[model samples]
Target: MWGRRRKHRPKEYFIFGTIQEEDRVIRINPSLDQPFVPLWFLRYVLYHEMLHSVVPDETVSGGRRRVHTEEFNRRERDFPSYCRARRWEEENLARFLR
Candidate 1:
């Protein structure tokens, strides 16, 4: 779930993306003034959310968000070039429209 589309929208920045019980959807920030985010970076984030949707045992004990599990890391490892995607997101594009 990228986000639930309500009759009245909430703050747009908070709507970057979301994960529902069994599905994941990523809503790109259209109001973002950046020219474009590379495809691989988007795929990486989408994969991150997809992992949450696929694994049902993710549990949060308290305020901490413990969505990732050992199995989640293993699933993430299946992506051969995860490092490259992280590098692109961290080093190349960090700033965005406010």
Candidate 2:
């Protein structure tokens, strides 16, 4: 599955990458070039980004995207390595941002 920044977004589509809601941009990490990463992990990130579509507060306030709300965090933990994955992403986003 690919998540491209389309010229026109369809009514309903599942995105598997980070989406810049303000700009309607969808960015896929090339480092994830290989799809061998666990589906759970991939899904975790996708859903994480999808949350932005609903969380308007992330933009109005000058704060980090609360990818993990108290309930989101509690529920996301069930995905396994949720914390670890987030930490890994934080530590390695620089290498993967390209």
Candidate 3:
């Protein structure tokens, strides 16, 4: 449940965080290291990644990998302060992109 700051990347890269299943680690974007970032938001992102560790992967009819399955979304909503975290992300996305 720890995240490390990564090198600054352009918004075009559109990368945030990634979970390495093999290593069980989360690599976070450098933009998230700003002071404006709220703890709840960080917790939300971490929780989302942690969920991936427990949720089983899904395969569609076309054999496509569904990382965020319906069940995953459902469980995500169960997180305390889910709406608040999502709203904060939507409102502060530009700052992260900067």
Question: TM-score of every model?
Answer: 0.58, 0.44, 0.84
Clashing pairs in 1: none
The parts of candidate 3 lying over 4 Å away from their true place are 1-13
The residue pairs in collision within model 3 are none
RMSD (Å) per prediction: 4.8, 8.5, 2.3
CA lDDT, every model vs. true structure: 0.59, 0.58, 0.81
lDDT of 3 by residue, 1-98 (tens): 33555466666545567799998798766668778888788888888888999999999889999999999999999999999998988787776665
Candidate 2 Cα errors over 4 Å, as ranges:
1-16, 20-26, 58-81, 87-98
- Summarize candidate 1's per-residue lDDT along 1-98 as a digit string, tens digits: 23334555454333334565633455554432235666676677677777777775655667566656788888887876798876765564435312
Better of 2 and 3 by TM-score: 3
* Residue 38 displacement in candidate 2 (angstroms): 1.7
Name the candidate, 1 or 3, with the larger lDDT value. 3
State in Å the error of residue 60, model 3: 1.5
Candidate order by lDDT, decreasing, is 3, 1, 2
Best by lDDT: 3
Residue 20 lDDT in model 2? 78
How many clashing pairs per prediction, in order? 0, 0, 0
Give per-residue lDDT, candidate 2, residue 83. Answer: 81
